[model samples]
Target: MTVAKTINRKLVKTITQRSLSTIAPQVRIYEVGPRDGLQNESKFVPTDIKIELINKIAAAGIKDIESASFVSPKWVKQMSDGVDVMKNLPRAPGVNYPVLVPNLKGYDTARQCNVEEVAIFPAGSEGFSQKNLNCSVEEGLKRFKLVADQAVKDGLRVRGYVSCVVGCPYDGPIHPKGIAKITEQLFEMGCYEVSLGDTIGVGTAGSVQRLMREVLTVAKPEQLALHFHDTYGQALSNLLAGLEYGIKTVDSSISGLGGCPYARGASGNLATEDLVYFLYGLGVNTHIDLVKLMEAGRYISNYLGKPTESKVNRALGDRFKNHNDIAKMASCDV
Candidate 1:
């Protein structure tokens, strides 16, 4: 009788856990550290390290990784070796390595590398569109539409990014309607998915909820992804608000790398370690190997000669370090 009762309790616990996880389903983490995270480095990261860093992120179980950008060296000196990085990457099976292309020229250059997918970045704020692309938003979208059309004909998937969803440095406090309009156009432009970026990270949960309600009106939750920077410490909260509305995809960087070059006060993206830890706690399935992910974060942070910006990585790093120290001590003569 006692054994039967214990088995019955265990079965009930497993069923309850499964039910809890069904609230949001699986969360797909698109790792953007190699491209967005490292783009701002004043020092050029050697192509070798970039390749290894990307592979490490992939080994950590990230299905999608932004490998490089095909912009000119005059603009982003760090990504000057974009072609070599793409050509030499040991393109793993079952993983998507998408590169960012600024215009038809960049997209055509990326085509030579036989990339599987290409991502187009067009900011929602007119100020950013002029500053970043040196044109109005309408003109910029027209250019990207040509690129998207060509990419489709070439048999490559196109991903869209709408930056400055919540606020902008030059424009400031962008209305949700503008964001939705851009999202709607991108969806109609042959982009299988679009990632909305809170580039300056000034968004609150209330702001995120408001944006969610507006953006969802034009695009379904599954067709969109959230990219939030941690400048104001609200990235996690803003994500939670979006999650409440059933969005399951997020873009995060390892060790919290990346800052807006165009926006002065903005910061790095929300740390991958932080996001995965948060989701795991809520019983949401991320399918990421946290230990491997942390190792990858530590590798890049060490290479960059800086402490990591991830709070979760800092916490677990010490624990793992102490554990390793104890293991070493025990191996020595008692």
Candidate 2:
């Protein structure tokens, strides 16, 4: 099936009209910094700093934020205090704060916290499915159904995620049909939207476009989001391919902080700063202050004691220091 066949008539018209106009506006950036960005940290980030980081991120005008996860503490240490994070953070007015919920128990926890939006994920590759969740695809979907059903009953919006959609660490390559099947199941299970993730970051633009060709058959672009990892330096390229297919929503992390545990050499998700820069360059409004975003990334990276993985952040830092040094030299001459 073609791209045109997958998107709804209204969505296609909207995308085409937007793409044609030079003054075409904003791109929605789903901030996955708190959840996806911190998941791979070797050290525990203090809860205080985590709250502070989230506050700063919201202050920077990020409208959609993935705040935390409701998974078992034993499995994801970074989100052990998921409930506390939900309770303490200064909620951004009009912002949508979604949390990751693994199963029915997670949904119950999120409901107790009064969170209305939650996300559940399944692996696109069979090997990854076993390694990540210790089950077959059929069993995982059964588990996801429990969460998705409860979420809807509780008046919560559920977002579905299919990880390793393009390539898998254990499985060498993925067939697009597999992506279509998982995505269709998620949508059928009451997920309002599904995000396709290139978890191992091995996708190219051409391959991604082709894979999307199959996925869009069963899911509308409006009901889908793209999550690309920069492991092979192809995240942006793959993102462009999605854009061409009229995918509007994207998940990105601030400063590109996390990496895949299953794929040793894989890089983090695409950085929020770079996404904003690229969107702005394309005359797309993200409503994000790029300079403020850089500051937010730098603040967290300092606490983490690591150089930021974002190339845009690194260059911007160098430019600022260079200008400051130049100013000092001019002052000395005076």
The prediction achieving the highest lDDT against the true structure is 1
TM-score of 2: 0.88
- Tens-place lDDT per residue, model 1, 1-334, is 6999999999999976664543486899999999999998776789999999999999888999999999998999988999999999998889999999989999989999989899999998999999988999999899999999999999999999999999989998999999999999998999999999999999999999899999999998899999999999999999988887788899999999999999997889999988887877666777787777888999999999999989888977845533233223333524
Global CA lDDT computed for model 1: 0.89
* Deviation from truth (RMSD, Å), model 2: 8.5
List candidate 1 segments past 4 Å from native: 1-23, 318-334
Error of 1 at 270 (Å): 0.8
Worst 10 residues of 1 by lDDT: 321-330
Model 2 residue pairs with clashes: 26-285
Cα shift from native, residue 244, model 2 (Å): 0.6
Error of 2 at 219 (Å): 1.8
How close is each model in CA RMSD to the real structure? 6.8, 8.5
